[model samples]
Target: MLKKLLIANRGEIAVRVIRTAKALGYRTVAVYSEADANAMHTEIADEAVCIGPAQVAASYLNADVILEAARKTGADCIHPGYGFLSENADFSNACKEAGIVFVGPPASAIELMGSKRRSKIAMQKAGVPVVPGYEGDNASDDELIAAAAGIGYPLMIKASAGGGGRGMRLVEKESDLAENIKRARSESKQAFGDDELILERAVIEPRHVEIQIFADRHGNAVYLGERDCSIQRRHQKVVEEAPSPFVTPELRAAMGDAAVKAALACNYEGAGTVEFLVDKDRNFYFLEMNTRLQVEHPVTELITGQDLVSWQMTVAEGLPLPLAQNEIELNGHAIEVRLYAEDPSNGFTPQTGPLHIFKPAEGEGLRFDTGVRSGDEVTPHYDPMLAKVIAWGENRDEARRRLIRALEDTTVFGVTTNRYFLSRIIADSKFGAGEATTAFLQQEFSEDPSLQPAKLNIRQLALAAGVLAHGTVGEQAWSNAPATITPMKLDTGESTVELLVHNKDNVLSCRLGDQHHEIVLASIEKDTLCIIDNGIRQRCQYHRDGDSLYLQAFGESWSVTDLTHQPAAGANGAGSGRIQASMDGAIIDVLAEPGQTVRQGDTLVILEAMKMEHPVKADCDGVVSEILTKKGDQVKRKQLLVEITTN
Candidate 1:
């Protein structure tokens, strides 16, 4: 068995590996960046080291420094948990050269399966069905464009070396070919350091399913099962389930067999996933292979009754396969929803701030995998995934209902999250029926009014704020008289919530829009409030930053404004209109000029953030008076980007 294992990663994954390593009697070493010195992983390890700064290139991806940390810690093995260097071929080779065990696949296997184009060709050669496309070596732009035409319209241009849809684009017509190709190449270069691309005939409304396969050094491998990852947004999975509801035994066997074949072809070892795009007709074609433990691995673990991380460790120590294909049994169904620090109401833009309240749901058959806690800040330097909530049950409907209940009961205040949105997806009739496709979000949930939070009076919030900003019956309580007193107004930017309030005899009554709710401060703790509303007590979690309060209640997180005492504002950009940066990000491209004419909906600027491109369009017809920021400039949220003299 390996003696000491150094984790070359961070967040929940590092913590996850550390727990398993410790339980298996192996000492663990944690590596962190400057920003994560006080992180949970660092705190939990037997030993810790600061690798570099918060920037990924300087820290997590810094292979040499990570190796040095291993050497200094006298670790016998380096476990590149999932991201960062988990699939980096060079890093694996370096670990081998340093006489350190790389707890993953062979460097040669990563090299073979790392690129989508190469992997597809290998699969094709191994008799696995693959989508027809162009993956020729050293192809020019014109060659790729020509190949796209050959592949026909409505094809996908994918980064030859990408996953998670970083460098993928769908071209519906010939007019979009050039621009899509250019953007794809640029994004590919930035994400994977390879500008090469592969073209594929788009599989319409396919069910995204992947088979989990594990191999050992002794030429033994077995496919565990398949996971349905069809629920997606921007081409990344949002919800994943084990023992796919849409897959029958016959289809599962075929997919599993093909996955085993692919593993064998690569001379694979350790844990890997072979993904496929299954059409409505049950015809599955080879998609890219992910050479690491997936984010949704818990669902598989729940259904299979196995600890995959342990298998990886045992295999890394030169052990044979843990079990044969016949020994493995899929016992139950499991579903997992990714909890992200993102605003679903807004284009799923990643949110950053302190998690004033990070409470994961608890019950039978529930597993919460998280990193951050209350008071921890959600930074822009890392992925926005806050946690993974997995629920297991005896059947698909049982699992689905359990997942829905858990998701709707969870609370994560301070940062805007997709928690509410995840619940909506799982509760939908189509999703519960296992009819979710790759286009599920775009087709059924995009801008769905039902997903938006129900609007409430800011005055009730102000009353809660009054208790939070001061305290119940404290030195800061609202003062000076007939306590059933004055009226106040709160502007939420979208609407002004008028309020008539007073606090007397422990009863607080506030009226809003022909409705009234009597509020009594039951209790108050730091970031938590217990309010008695009309003889019923309800507890809520909240964090106040100036006039904005991020609160959580009834499985939803929201940001409310308390403008009880601010000057009334004119319409946004009332006079000299300027299109401001919607969020803090880097300017990738500028389509408007200082003197350019623009219409109400023409793209004026493009910003790249959280690994996605957001086009900023003109809100009104105007002549651009000034362009404050240029391409490649880093911008702050709400900063003036393009000044326009509206007609």
Candidate 2:
């Protein structure tokens, strides 16, 4: 066994690796950037080392610095958790040359599977079903365009060297090919240091399922079922579950065998995942292979009751397969949802700030893997994912129910989150029927009325006002409060909520838009508010910062701002024709220049955040007057990017 293991990552993944390695009787070393001086992973490690600055290239991705940190800490091996250099074939080779064991597949295996073109050809040679496409090295734009013509319309252009849905474009028509191909090449170059791409026929609404495969140096490998990750937005996975509802026993066997073959074809060692795009007909085509532990590995652990990380450590120590294929058993249903500091209604824009309140849910068969605390600062330099909330049960429905409740039980404040968005998707009708597809957001929410934000009635507004005014002061404030509560208005999204409040003798009442309700606060304890209305008790947890109030209860989480002090209301694009960034990020492109004319809905500026690109488009025909930020400049939320004069 190794004497010590150095984790070459940060955030929750690093924390997870350290914990497992420590439990396996190995000293753990944590490496971090300057920005993560006081991060959770650093605080929990046996030894911590500062590698470089905040930028990934200077810090986590600096192979030389990371290897030095390992040597300084006397680490016998290095674990590259999920992202960063986890799949970098060069990094693995460096570790080998340095006499430091790398806890992953061989360098040759990584290089083979790292190339989408080469990997697909290898899989085809191994008799694994591969999607029909072109993987030729002649990837000139003209060559790709000709290849697309032969492949047919609506094909997928994917980066040959990267995953996580980055550098992928779905070209719907031949006319859209050039722009998408260029964008894919640029993003691919930035993300993976490679501009080469491969074209594949897009499988419409296929279930994005992947199998977990473990192998050792002794020519042994085993498959551990599969996970369904169909719930997505912008081609990024949000929710994943084990033992997919779509896959049956027979189908599981076939896909699992194919995944094992894909691994053996490269003499794979350590832990890796084989992804497949399974159509409705049960036919599965090989997707790419992830050459490290997955982000959603917990769901698989919950179902199989096995420690995959521990297995990885053992396998890397030159042990044979821990469990054969027949020894592994899928026991229960498990599901996981990624909780991010993002806004679902506002284009899923990533948010960054101090986490004022960071209470996570706790219960049976529920787990929360997080890296942030109440006072932690969510910086824009890293991914916006705050944590992953996962749940398990005896069956799929029970697991789904537990997951929804777990999300509702969570309370996060100070920044935007996708908590409510996650709840709504799990409760979606198509999801309830086990018919979820990649078009889940478009098909269900676009057609469902109830999925829209809930409008507050007079009663709810009265409660909200009372919480803001009398919060932390207890119910006794009602006695000294004004008899006729002040008339106030709050701004929530596009609606301006106006109401008049009346507080007298420990009771609160409100009137607005032909409605009225009286409420009495029973008590207050920290952030929990217990109130009584119409002889019914409702206990809700809330957080207050200035005029902003975030409340969660009764299966809903709402954020309301007290705009009573403001003199008037304003729409999102009202009056000022300034185009502002919707999130904190770097400028990826300046699509329109000053003095340039643009039509309505034309993209003017492109912002990159959390590895995704968001375009700032013109709302009306206008001429660009100024550009506030240029390409490669970092920006903050609501920061002005451009000025346009509408004609």
Candidate 3:
């Protein structure tokens, strides 16, 4: 076993790798950007190094800095975790040249699998089923149009070097092809530094099934079964599970065989994943291969009862195959939900704030991989993924139940997250019936604003009432003389709540409508309160800036403004305004400029943020007055990008 290893990444994945490295009696070194100087992963590592500023390119993606950190820390191996340079062939080669183990597949394998076009060609040559599309080098527009016609309508244009759903466009008609292709190319170049693209037939209602394959340098390889990752938003997976409910035993065996073949074709070694797109007819086609550990690898670990990180270390240490194909057995069912720092009610936009309270559920067969803690700030400069919660049970239903329970019990305050949305999804009737597809969120949940809380005041009231019942009001408590007891009334547009408080013996009792409850005072600070109610404690953090009370509960935050105090006239200014940039990003395209007359719902501009492109559309019929930002210009949130003059 290695004595020490350096993790060349950040966030939950870095923390995850550290835990396993420590379990194997290896000292861990964590590298951090300026923003992550006080992050949880850095605090947990045996030694930490500051690499560069907050920008990923200056820190996490800086190969020279990472290698220098490894050399300085005396680490024998460097674990890329899952993102950053995990699959960068050059980074792998650099580690090898520096005489440090990369703890992943060989550089050649990464190079072959990292490019989608090249991977498709290799899979096709190896006799593996591939999607019908064009992977040729011709970039002519006419050639692409011909390829699309041959592949039929409703094809997908994807970046050849894309991952995490960036640089992909779905074209259902020929008329929409040119613009989408241009957008995809621009986004692909901006995201991956590669503008190369490939077109493929869009598989309708497909289930994403991926096989985890491990190989030793000695020409031995084995597949650890399959994981179903059909629950997604914008082509990015949100929930994943091992031993898919839809995959039959025979189909699993066949996919496993094909995955092994793909690995052997590249002389692959260490850990890698072969992803496939399974259509409604159960026909599977090779999608691509990930040449490093995946974000959802916990599900596979749960079912196999194997520590994949340890295995990676062993393989890097030149150990031969320890388990044969026949010796591996599919155990129980396991499911994982990725908790992101995003607001589901707002098109799942990314959110940033301090994590005032962070708590993870604990129980049998429950696992949590996290990177942040209480008081840590989640910045917008990195991926919004907060943590991965995994649950294992005897079967799929039991596993789903456990996962839902775990998600409900897990609490995060100070920023918005998708905890409630995830709970709703896992408990949905269709999801429970095993009828999920890649379009699950878009078709059933995305457009339905009613599925999410229109107002979080009810939950906020519950938490606040719980806090007031706990007598933490300090010197503001009512005097022995009959003092004027002020009743707190909260309105949420749909409902109203009034709380009556009585305090004695450092304890508080409150009447909430027809129910009476008691609580113990924990602490009370400026603008926030913490309390214990009926032996179950919950922390309620709120800010009373003037008449507005911002309440955050269970990772979903909302503001309750006092309607009694009306806003000053003309506070918002002007009669009509053009839709502005909602967040900091690069302007990918200007679909409409000055003097262009457009109607409501007409696309005006495309803004790319966090590697995803968002289309900003006209809200009303108007003629464009000005276009302030051009394509490739970086913009800030609420910056004026366009102006319109209504007729």
Top candidate when judged by TM-score against the true structure: 2
RMSD (Cα, Å) of model 1: 4.7
How many clashing residue pairs appear in each of the predictions shown? 0, 0, 0
Cα lDDT tens digits, model 2, 85-141, are 998899999999999999999999999998999999999999899999999894899
User: Per-candidate TM vs. native?
Assistant: 0.85, 0.88, 0.80
Question: Which stretches of model 3 miss by more than 4 angstroms?
Answer: 447-453, 456-647
Candidate 2: worst-modelled 10 consecutive residues by lDDT:
567-576
Q: In model 1, what lDDT does residue 416 have?
A: 71
Clashing pairs in 3: none
Give the Cα-based TM-score of candidate 3 against the true structure: 0.80
Give per-residue CA lDDT, model 1, range 1-647, as digits (tens). 67999999999889888999999999999999997898888999999999999789999999999999999999999999988999999999999999999999999999989888888889999999999889988577899888887889789999988888889999899899899989999999997799988899999999999999999989998999999999887888889999998999999999999999999999999999999999999999999788889888888999999999999999999999889999999998999998998877666788765677787778888888877787787766789888899999999888888888788777777667888788888888888877889988888877675356446554445455445334333342334345655465554433555676666655666666577667776666666667776567887767666666666666665565665555544234323356877666789999988888888878999987676688887877889998888999977666789878888
Q: lDDT of each model, Cα atoms only?
A: 0.83, 0.85, 0.81
The residue pairs found clashing in candidate 2 are: none
